[model samples]
Target: MNIGIVVFPGSNCDRDCAYVASDVIGQSAQFIWHQETSLGEMDAIILPGGFSYGDYLRTGAIAHLSPIMDAVKAFAKQGGLVLGICNGFQILLESGLLPGAMLRNRGLSFRCEEVYVRVENAETPFTNQCHPGQVLKIPIAHAEGNYYTDPVTLSSLQANAQVIFRYCDADGQSTGPSNPNGSLDHIAGIRNAAGNVLGMMPHPERCAERALNNTDGFLVFQSMVASLKTQARLTAR
Candidate 1:
């Protein structure tokens, strides 16, 4: 599958995300400029981890209104796959593509560390390869990763199984320290109602290979590719 990684002015991890697909795993991938309005010949798009716009006004608040995001919104509306990581996750929330808003980390500091995450909705495209409640270790670096939603919204998300990933420990147990940002219910990642868009603070690109530590993140990508293939076949039918 051909993947496009979006790059804004402060997108430090666009290349990293592309390399994970192209170089690390040998898939076709390209860098999509932030100003570009079209998605090009792409099966998937990723808004990578970074301090976009230098987190100038607020995390993802400005970048959410970028022109290219229009195309992304349309792409996602068509049931196309889109993944947002770190600052990208912030952007997704700001763009209203994903539910909830981000708040300052409970500690109010930029955190950089590897932590365990448990898959809560493995049936979704982003986690299809993972079994429900499987634990994966991935790295995260961010300051405002605390996720918040109204009680009614949270209940809705839980009912629809949109709650995708949660912070956990090595043994796949959810706990306090495992939560890097003290997020509500330790929500580290989530998906839209359609299950085509994913927003997560953890950096899957950071662990695309086993040599890096754990290869758990690859299942997320592999599942996405598989989901696209499956969707295509279903449409072809």
Candidate 2:
């Protein structure tokens, strides 16, 4: 599989995502600049974490207007896989690829720490390698990781199984203290109604390598690659 990592002006983790896609996952990876209007032949698209446009207007306000987002949205509409991390998740919200909005952390301070997230729906392409109720220790860094949505949308998400990951204790229980950003229902990640696009606050690439002493995050990438391989096989047949 070939992954395309979008690079905005303030994007700092594009290289990390690229390394995971190419070096660790043994898939071709390329950097797609914000100005680029096309996604080319990428199998998957990733919006990496960073303070795009310095987060001046809003976390992803200005960045979402980039010409590339049009392509991203179109790709997702065509059943392409899209994953957004941290600021990338913010961009997805701003671009309307995913639902909901991000608010300031509970205390309005930047948080950088490790948090455990329980897999809520492991049947999605992005989480197929994980089992239901599995816990993953991932690191999150942001001031506006708090997720919010209207009651109706929340209910819809729950009914449709769009909620993928939720902050939880090591024992896989959701609790207040385990909620790092005070996100409603401790939502750590969610997918679009179509399940092809995913937006999450945690940085999986940061903990995907053994050198980092934690390979739990690697499962996210592994699942994506595995899903793509399965799709290729089906297509060939």
Candidate 3:
């Protein structure tokens, strides 16, 4: 699948996403600047982690207003796939493309380390390669990564299998200590109601290659590619 990595000012991970998509995943990829209104022929789009606009306002508050978001929104509405990682997750929240908001890490400090996340739902495009309850070791870097949502929204997400990943121990058990950010319900990742958009706080691109010490992140990209191919086949019928 053709992928487009969105880049905004202060977006440090755009290149990482591109490199993973092109070099690691062996897929066609390109960088889409925030000001550009067109996404061209991208089959999927990724909003990589970074302090867009230097996080001048609240995280994701300003970047949500970018000109390209309109296109991204339209694309997602039409069943296009979109993945937002870390600060990109914050942007998706601010854009209303995903539910919930991020809060300061419970410790009131930044966190930069690897954490284990269990695959709560393996049906979504982003996690289809994982087994149910499988654990993935991925790194997270952020200060305000605590994800929160009202009870009503959380219930709906649970009912619809939208909660895709949760912080967990190496054995795939969710526990308080395993939750690095103290996110509500240990949520590390979630998909939209329609299941086409995903927003997660972990940085998958950081460990997508063997050189990164772990290649578990590659499964996420592989899942997307497989999903896209299946979609293409169904559409062609």
Tell me the tens digit of each residue's lDDT in model 1 across 1-237. Answer: 899999998999898888888977677999988898998988999999898998988899889988899999999998889999999999999999999999999999989988899999889888989998999888899999999999999998999999999999988888888788989989999999998999999999888897887788898888888888898899899
Clashing pairs in 1: none
| TM-score, per-candidate, Cα-based | 0.97, 0.99, 0.99
lDDT of each: 0.91, 0.96, 0.94
Collision count of model 2: 0
Give the higher-lDDT candidate: 2 or 3. Answer: 2
Q: Which order, best to worst by lDDT? A: 2, 3, 1
C-alpha lDDT of candidate 1 relative to the true structure: 0.91
Candidate 2 backbone collisions, by pair:
none
Alpha-carbon RMSD, each predicted model: 1.1, 0.6, 0.7
Residue-level lDDT of model 2, residues 58-151, one tens digit each, is 9999999999999999999999999999999999999999989999999888999999999999999899999999999999999999999999
Question: Residue 22 deviation, candidate 3, in Å?
Answer: 0.5
Q: Candidate 3 on 1-237: residue-level lDDT in tens? A: 789999999999999999999999899999999999999999999999999988987999999999999999999999999999999999999999999999999998799999999999998899889999999999999999999999999999999999999999999989999999899999999999999999999999999988878998998999999999999999999
lDDT of 3: 0.94
